[model samples]
Target: MDISAPSLRAVFTAVKTEFNAGRSTYTPTYTRIATVVPSTTSSEDYAWLGEFSRLREWIGDRHINKMALHSYSIKNKKFEATEGIPSEYIEDDTFGVLMAKFQDMGYAAATHPDELTYACLASGWNTLCYDGQNFFDTEHDVGEGENEKLVSNMQDGALAPWYLLDTRRPLKPLIFQKRKDYQLSAKTDAGNSDHVFMADEYLYGVDARVNAGFGFWQQAFGSKAELTEANFNSAIEKMMGLKSDKGRPLGINPDLLVVGPTNRSKAKALIEAMQKEGGASNTNYQAVEVMVVPWLD
Candidate 1:
């Protein structure tokens, strides 16, 4: 495998094939729990998220809800992954390894969104949402004055966190803000590139601009306690009982449960089992789809 332009091009094609193949094999889980929001500039304002409205019977004039302009925004962040292969690797006929490397790179690139979304989710306990409250806090305002009731979306404890989500709605608990889709690029112009001339290497990389942020905290419940059936039931109860700012039922249906490697067995036994451990009829059987994600780990 001599370092001719044609040969280098052949290597690029092979590497790109592996990269695409890698991307094709991955099944990202973020789509299930995050809404994709396209961004045009460096950031997108979500200050309008201050309210969630519902349809009501018409009386007279239309009720207009003004955007609060709370300065809440999701800024796009640039991300990149790059690798350079020594010209000697192609000369040594080790392009197969490079193919695998690019494939893994593609896999990693595909998984990045999930990583950001879930990390944003996992930080719900502390990070603020559009309402100026932690996405999973216990002090979210449901109403004003005497009608106000402090609500919580999280249960704190000393263990790995698991999440219950209501994804039946169009908007999910998280937002994946993508400014630019991930793309693969190469700098194999050996005649013109200083990197190629000086380093005797060909560079390949993937880059994109994307970020993740919390959506409706009302549609999600996080627990750091043990992942038990009782706790699961409690989480479901909490989420289902959630009310809107106007004190209307949010109608949140917890349809998905997310867990990490440490809580896989617990999550499975709680939902996947046909019966409770006591031989009693399991009331929570197949209640919700359980997702096991390594990114959560």
Candidate 2:
């Protein structure tokens, strides 16, 4: 059945709203987070993240918003925080105290895992880093050369210094193509005093780098265009045509198509359209695996 434009849009919007409402149940909290592995043996050191813009944002916009060309060299240091279980509380309580202790530990276990995914996804949707000069109505030159670091003092280093456009090193939040081989552990203090004890926890983190640029592994900007077969095909072309840092054509066949909840039906239609076996065959057939991401919406 043919769908009218207005009706189709409405359907897309409604699907997104409903999917978002029940999305929590289907979200795998660790899918993206668990991809990062230990970049360093010690947590005190910093993990370097790299990013390279395949194309400047202005090129795609109708209005040219001329901005500095950025190549990133951001650093992600492992963060350390402590949460403890009192011996008295766990030891004295007879009912569910042990379980409660375990629950608290679970939260601690989840904290870093959740944070890694959050940070990576957020960076993709947001800017890499901001230097104070680029605050309001102006933008800063990310500068050239790896030696030239755009260091922004975010509250006297309350967080790792946000760096911008360092050619020496490409930076991105930690993203890995292979399974991260590592373990999470909590260590008890060597000795206890005053019946108060402490356990220090450490999470291994990797800096974000471009594992897959302008392709399935990397997030793509959809230009606020409504999802459709034609539009989706165009996006795939744009993605495949993306250039590398070396200014060479990145002949990438994107194996996955990630969409927001609003694009679910559109994605399905695009896939089905490609599967037809005749003159009706869509040029882009099974171009990529489609994944509906509610978090992206």
Q: Pick by TM-score: which candidate is best?
A: 1
* Candidate no. 2 TM-score: 0.44
The lDDT of each candidate is 0.89, 0.36
Residue-level lDDT tens digits of model 1 in 1-297: 888899988888888999999998888989899999999999998877756668888899998866556667998999999999998999998868768889999999988998989899888888999888999998987886789888988888989999999998888889999999999999998889999999998999999999999888899999999998789899999899887666788888999999999999999988998987879877888999999988775
Clashing pairs in 1: none
The residue ranges of model 2 lying beyond 4 angstroms of the native Cα positions read: 1-38, 41-71, 78-89, 92-115, 129-222, 243-248, 272-285
The TM-scores, one per candidate, come to: 0.94, 0.44
Model 1: ten consecutive residues of lowest lDDT: 63-72
lDDT of prediction 2: 0.36
